[model samples]
Target: MSETPAASVSRRRLLARSGAVGAGIAFSGALTEVFAGTAAARGLGDRGYGPLVPDPNGLLDLPKGFRYRVLSREGDPLRSGEGRVPSNHDGMAAFGGRHGRVHLVRNHENRPTAAIRVPPVEGLTYDPAGAGGCTALTLDADGAVRSERVAIAGTAVNCAGGPTPWGTWLTCEETEDKAGTNGYTKDHGFVFETDPVDPRRTGAVPLTAMGRFQHEAIAVDPRSGAVYETEDAFQRPFGLFYRFLPDRPLGGTGSLRAGGRLQAMRVPGLPDLSSVQEPGARFGGVEWVDVPDPLAAGTPIRLQDFGPRGITHAQKLEGCYWGGRSVYFVSSYARSAEGSAADHFGQIWRYDPAGRWLTLVVVFGPDTGVQLPGESPDNICLAPSGGLMVCEDGGGAQHVYGVTRRGEVYALARNRQNPGTEEEPEWGEFAGVTFSPDGSTMYVNCYTPGTTFAVTGPWAGQPGR
Candidate 1:
């Protein structure tokens, strides 16, 4: 992705202001003040797409000159003449399609009892009893959905996942449902690949070698095709970051089922590193330990094996995206209530493959109620303007936040969809924030009410672009 000159300058200024160019400084209250001040100084709040204009339909709030159109909604009829679109739309990926259009492979984070389910087809169902799966949508140049159909079916809790370099979506099951348990014939916690190009061409196949746990999201290294996964188990045992080194490179005709080695991340000096001191905290010289059993036998892989080994644990490791040769991930709201070392508003970590080090980038402070530009970032994607657009999954009104390369933060869009009274707008978290290949439109999903929207505007002037 290319960056515009203005965005390049903003990012350069951000690095200098945040001291990211320096060895690394602990991001604390003082640093937060500096960041806020820098945002004000650059008039970031007023620039880059300007303020959001409320939607008359009371669905989405976007900046001036920008407008959103609802692409698909829950309970909408499927083009396949099957069941309606499943609820709880989560992670999604955009792929270039025929006739200068885009195809979106979207996950439906439903369970066995979901009101609607992705219609199951022979050979595509992982567990006939499970209901969660993915749906593929083809969008025209105007961001209107042309066709929609089930991409994968019979999975469970199809949460956040990453796209592969070779044009495929890795849909991850976020449940540890065991075989012969809860009416499930097969184990649930696994990753399945779905091709948006032709949903019917590929069957849902579980990549069991990736390790079975409460999987959250994944990012693939385009160079080596190494898959990095994050676990979102939120308990005393928490979750660990994992790396899957495939026996062979994973693009082209590569298959994850061909088998790979799964390993857990371990920071040498920071054993059981749950209490991250502050954002910008750098842990270098990291190591990875082999996971004996990638497939969970009787217990979840992280708890039974990696947890006992003192693998560095994080609280609710959610959305992860690959950009700038690094994997940026989110830890949503680490606090005493969540059994974390410290009470944090949220944390964003960056893992540098070249340096083999993980560094804390942005940290939301302990003030949970504070309505800053962004907090509790969940699904993330790189902006065409060279920054990050983070989806908020926390309390209060949710928004999609834009972070300049220089670290200046601003709200890109806010959820104005309210089923209740206007005094108490029912805010739902945004997920699956992705940009079209040509950067003309951005797509995102509202978790509740289950809606997908296509947003278009003067994206080039946006802070992250």
Candidate 2:
């Protein structure tokens, strides 16, 4: 399928007309009175895919004719006859495997202080002190687990990463904690490539050329082999969107280690574009500024280097996906108090390489509740049926929302795991929302109370279509 270009004003108009704006309206120069007429203007009071049917298992709530099967959970014995399944299930990628099977490389976002750890395995670990790594799972055509094993170990905070076109998962470490300070022998914050077909081929090499910041996720451009990375750091020294232009096209393996030039994004004329504008606001004349030192020797790359170069900053840049020849990324949330020009519930940005223009496609207004269309979308996946499945990471009830090509929003699933106590019941956020190669099954992870589920339903009959 071809990419939806930034110049496609028709798509934006369709999104605006489909009530994709949700309860929150677009923010104008003034935040208070910005979305006053948005709900009425778009007639978006009754959005979403009907009502969600409460699950009897109390784990997840879904709409009618939908259900999920628990494929794996923390503490489950590994099929490899080694360690148990690690905790803090995070990002994952599913690939078509041999014999009509599917292989998934899942990330464990465990830190040194975590209770359960990804056991240190010989040749599969990076730092012995780190507990974060990845696991490989093989599922049959019916989505039944055939085998599971530790793919990589001894890493730190394997938060989120993207799949390469050549059939490998690039797991990213979402931390910059220096080695020797936190009992770590080597540096943290680096991306590692894993081969699901052969766990033995999984090396402990770090893609240092991709810069050393709190790397959140990556999306690779198949046409040019350029890797787009996102930083999840939030503070006075925020994160900048990065592009790693490899010296050579990425191939079977070890191509990332060949070294590359790391560059940060700079929108000319809008140097300080806070990304807090209304939905459909387009920014032109985008440029890429070379980072003198991608290694960031003893200095934070975002604050010390890119910040000084006038690189445009984003608030908590998270999941990114390559689809339709364009790279779509998420900025969890931006606010004036957080150094942004205006306050926004969340923002989704699309970068069109063909036009070299960055456009704001989806923007959540000031409604912080999950009952709204979508808020704080973290990990994103493009549906095979031509829509976007976004995992919401927000304060209220967490949900997985579906955004149609025309910008209609619908609730696909909701977190129903209750702790039996009164400590804010629905707190777990959904992560690793990905579809199988054939698009029959969808897999996702619940961050807290870590559990991985395989969801299958009438996806084609969903509202996004």
Candidate 3:
């Protein structure tokens, strides 16, 4: 797969407003101030409903017809003899097999500075590179892995990913591969495509065109061949949203692992989009812009209408996915201008290409009163009833919360693992969630104890009351 450079696009010109605005281009401070006065002018109401805010003191909980169970846990031995799960297991994906089993592509978000290194043939261990990466596991659909192999040769810190209709996983490396002597490993940040079934048959192609920034989660539009992505920001500058458009579009055999154009989110005309006032201030009035020359032929459109002043910067935006007609994502860190908690809640936003919309679907802060900053809303899954399942990375304990279509928040399952027990509980303290294809079964992974869960029950569909 390392034969040559990607097939390059010849030129760049004005492409029609292909329905949804391309990416969230950066907005300038000047335009932000201007739009602040009229931020409410644009109609952002048609797309989505609000977020689900719930209480904390409560442990495992949910609304109705919903239930959860543990599938995999830390220290659990594998049939393949690969190894046990590491300290922090952050993200995962599921694949269907012809023989009643499911193939899962999971990530272990371990720290480079700590934790035990895994062995070969079964699991993976990094030498000095970044401390997170992916593993291929074959499960029995009952949520059991028959075998697991660390596919890619030297991948580190693999976070969230988007699945391909052609049947592949695009695992993103979050740590920037900035060598320049100060480099941690070998410039470890780039998207790699892998086969969930055949880990050894995988390919590691750095999407050089996608730019080399810290990548969080990636969601792709199978029909449009457009890939939507999010950045996970900790204490650094606010992470920006992005898009990668391939020349030929998605589908076919080997098309996904190759070339394309990458563009960062910029509210055109608005300078230095990084500098924003508060979390919910609302840049709702800003127009989307394109990045000029970005990574390839797809030059940024550069819209100058939306200003930066009214926009809310996501100090931490981790999870993102393209479900139905909208590109949806979650923000882990939310702050206020006074440095307090801005509404103090983490938020979820939906972006539509055709209708050109970005709606804040849910806000989980104000209700919990747990404004401890970046505690809730880790990875998320879209359930059947227009509901969302959220993982909490908060204080004292970790659990999964169920959000209803009516924006009602409830706890579905709590962590059974506590300080005293040597026996890890049913729900792993760490949370990573993925729903089965039919949406009947919900699979969750614990980040703390490194466990996997499968939740099943009578699930009610959307259009909630």
lDDT of each: 0.74, 0.75, 0.53
What would the per-residue lDDT of candidate 3 be over residues 182-276, giving only the tens digit for each residue?
A: 33555655677777877555555555666555567888876698888776644334566778887767654357546676655544333332233
Winner of 1 and 2 under lDDT = 2
Better of 1 and 2 by TM-score: 2
By TM-score rank, best first, the candidates go 2, 1, 3
> Which residue runs does candidate 2 get wrong by more than 4 Å?
1-49, 306-309, 366-374, 423-426, 462-465
In terms of TM-score, how similar is model 1 to the real structure?
A: 0.86
Best by lDDT: 2
Q: Which candidate is the best by TM-score?
A: 2
Clashes of 2: 0
Residue 91 error, candidate 1, Å: 0.4
Please give, for residues 394-448, the per-residue lDDT of candidate 1 as tens digits: 5446789776545545567988776556775556678999989987889999977
Clashes of each: 4, 0, 54
Model with the higher TM-score, candidate 2 or 3: 2
Pairs in steric clash, model 2: none
**How high is the lDDT of residue 304 in model 3?**
17
Give stretches of model 1 more than 4 Å off.
Answer: 1-46, 251-254, 272-274, 306-309, 366-374, 420-425, 462-465
